[model samples]
Target: MRIPVKHPWTLPKRLLGTFVILASIGRIQSEQKSSKQPNIVVIVADDLGWNDVSFHGADQIPTPNIDALAYNGVILNRHYVLPTCTPSRTAFFTGRYPIRTGMQGKPLSVGEPRGIPLNVRLLPEHLRNLGYRTRLVGKWHVGYYTNEHTPTRRGFESFYGHYSGYISYFNYTISKNNHTGFDLHQDTASTLEMRRNSNYATDVFTEEAVKVIENHDATEPLYLHLAHPAPHSSEAKEVVEVRNMSEVNSRFGYIENINRRKFAGMMMALDQSVGRIVKALGDANMLDNSIIVFMADNGAQTEGFLENYGSNYPLRGLKFTHYDGGVRGVACIYSPLIKNNSRVSEQLLHVTDWLPTFYSLAGGDVNDLGDIDGLDQWSAISLAENSARESLLINIDDAVNLRGVVSGKFKLIEGAADLYGNYYGDTGNNNSYPEYNITEILESDAGLAITSIGNSLLTETKILNLRSASIVRCNNFTDFANCSDTCLFNLQNDPCETTDVSADYPEIFISLSKMIEIFESELVPQTNTDVDPASYPEKFNGFWMPWVASDSSTIIATSSLIGLINILLHIFSLIFFS
Candidate 1:
């Protein structure tokens, strides 16, 4: 076929059009190339509470460094997570709801064979495929049974932490199954349990985190999970004692109550850890190009079996309960990509949202994470816009004991029993105190003075160096002693979730309760136990048992059995040869 002849002037016009199209394409390419490859460092505080941070109206305990990070970042005022450690972590790492992975309910004992399902891909695994280095520097509570469930086997390039929930900070031991043994591990295998260590768990984890930052490969991006288990004391101890006793006492004498004093010391040490990590990143000249995300794994654990003595004051409930106090937590994100460095984002977000958020921020498509429950909230977080997530399944227990749902400002929760089918949740710590808006205080002279105690910059310049969240100021919610049936509360008005308005909002209750039934339908049967040992050699579990207090008997029995086996084998061999 022959082309039709064009006018002589058409050639020039066509060339100009071609050049413009190419120029536009070149511009698009340039923008894509210039997109920042931020070094991501996610810092998680175990069982941290809303009122624990000094920036959030807690005057007795100071969290200067954490406040500084919150000031220089987007404060997420409506963040929520699971009611327990492993479920929260599983959600965060997998971008899927913990119930989907059968990780819902309580945390695993150190000796439990259960772990985060091996089939589900983790956030680090996704990042590792994208030319990033991944590391874990604290608790790995999801699972640690056979070698398959260890952190090294999961996707972490390097893991310098314990395999259990919370171990003795100094002794690095966990008490379980009527037995206590070493719990700390350097990589995957347990390190020599010397009974005592010169280093505390918090300090050791901080040191490892600093080293990860300092030794990061500049050419490649990084994704570090600095999961510090602080303000989380050992349930093994009746009276909680703060680590680094002399140092804590020297720095914090203002706190009068010894329990409060000990708790404050733990918080301060964690705060110091944040400062040290930030300093290390700054020293490495990666601060400006870094995306720092700080959050609590769950809400305050409170003075339950753990005696954490944490304050989720102004918020009702505590860890292991399907209530606001147990789910809502402290969270913030800081990066140059964010439009405003100091704004409180009221956008609703979930702990599960982080996997998608971080992957998207690192230039990965979240759509590839098939059938995930987390939504990509990058723009909502970085630009302070409305989050894509409007509703969430806070807790959908497979056991059908406790369940919760959030749609807009309305949240409905009911606790007939805990995950174990025991009647739980009769909230008593009613915080009738008025709201102390620290953000407003920062904008005033009085706030400048209050903020000066922890931040030296505020003292020198009479300016609040920290950023304040933009939440409404009002009185705290009223008291509700019990949550009968489905308790309903408008989170915006009664954020502490102290009132049970289920009687008035029957229609709203019906609507949200319907959602719970639908979600519950999709849940798998709860497996509160572990895989059987018949699948693996008995010798594989020759290590610590959660119930065993010591390894001496186990070692003696194991050796005696091994010798007997050897003698039997020799005799059998002689008989067969004869």
Candidate 2:
């Protein structure tokens, strides 16, 4: 103990000790932060309108849990997606435009012969390759006519829901003339048809999601896509009904309209489901560390009469249009990695941008994305200086009349629109609304910017309802290039595409036109354009059979008879031998 204080190595030894302690602490912190990449829980609601949530200034029904999520995270004010379901979902999975995937302006019906396309790698496939357990707990409207096109065959290790845009919450059965069967499924097999139960889809799906979170392997990161079909539609075809009738009176008894009341109840249930999932994560000790993304596939169908009676109020257009109301959605990303919370982001975030973003967060190299449309936005959403994407290639439906793109504050819309805000069919000079210049509509204090879409018998039918207001006619041409109309607007000054700045800014118009041309060139030829869904290939073979029919009692009786006969034969044989 006689070491002198004047020793040469004394100060150096003390500094070395300090450095070692600091290094160990840094390592521990890094380990805790980067344990196994945050679990990605993407909760998508079908047809959730812009003004649907309480945070979006809606007093009809307060989505407190959902509002809490938005307040605790960042509100994606400029988030954009496709006008329809399958198209947006296609863009989400492939990290490419829906036009490229042949789902440009239409959704895959009960038995469309085409889907995500073979040789295409989905978000789940890429994540699964990286040892992530991918689970899809709801709607998969992309495709399902064949076993190969099913969700389980795609990328998800497990899938538990319907293969269509929407389904009945209770009966779980659909009867569309020649196109009818059980919709619920576990993996590829129809669950409702197999087990035959009476459970509301929303509740059953929530329970399944909780199970997925609880039973997840902690060693691997998880990608759970809980897509809820709520406030969308039921078997009644664009008719809204709440699965939980008890909640209707409790949450929205004051709503005078039965349709609106049912919608409010469904929305309440959806909010409760979000809370349940959040709590489940907490129970599993994965809450604080998990990254939850809450968003909708597309805007709600607000412009159609008796069509989902949902409202995207304040936003100009409805579903199946190029209006901000149709494409823009309510979205938020919550995680500890995000530095700024309880704020709004004006950056242009696209649905296609999620694949690369999630992949980047999961420790995958962004360079491996490879020509994918989805840019890695991990840093941007994580409180980085700027988001990875500045502008978005908003909508590109060459098959129709209405389509546009968002660059900075400039938006170029090229098409005609009917009173319903849909450009699908010909308006025929009746109540022809301005698709490009809606400055008054956007600035007005009107209840709804647009009126109800009253289609004839062609309602919710095919896209070929030429006389109906579903299409812009396109010279009634079946070719993709027939949509030659165009309009441009400055969304900054005119949030409604009101002012025809296209004539003023010829350069911008030409630039957007060039981009659209290039994107269209890359688009795959359209498929599943058949007028009748029943005529789609492989319509009957193994798909048309009702897996859980009401007459299944006959099959059970037959099985019992066979069993009795077999037992009698065995006993008689034994007696004869004795």
**For this target, which candidate reaches the highest TM-score against the unseen true structure?**
1
lDDT of 2 at 360: 75
353-441 in candidate 1: lDDT tens per residue?
98888877776667767799999998888766789999999887766577889999999886634321121222212243223344433
Off by over 4 Å in 2: 1-34, 191-195, 303-306, 422-485, 531-578
lDDT per residue for candidate 2 within 1-578, as digits (tens), equals 01112233444687656545544554343344345678899999998887676555445665656655555566777789888888889899989887676678677766455677644668887676454789999888887654656777677989988777777777665555455566677886543254366677788899999999999876567889999987677766436767667767765666766777777788878877887787677667676667889998888775463267677765656777777778888787766557765466767789999999888787666676567888887767767447677666766666664567778878776774654553221111212211221222122211011111111111112211211221111122222222235667666666644446677898988988887777767877666554345433244433332122223344334433443343333334323432
Per lDDT, the best of the predicted structures is 1
lDDT of each: 0.69, 0.65
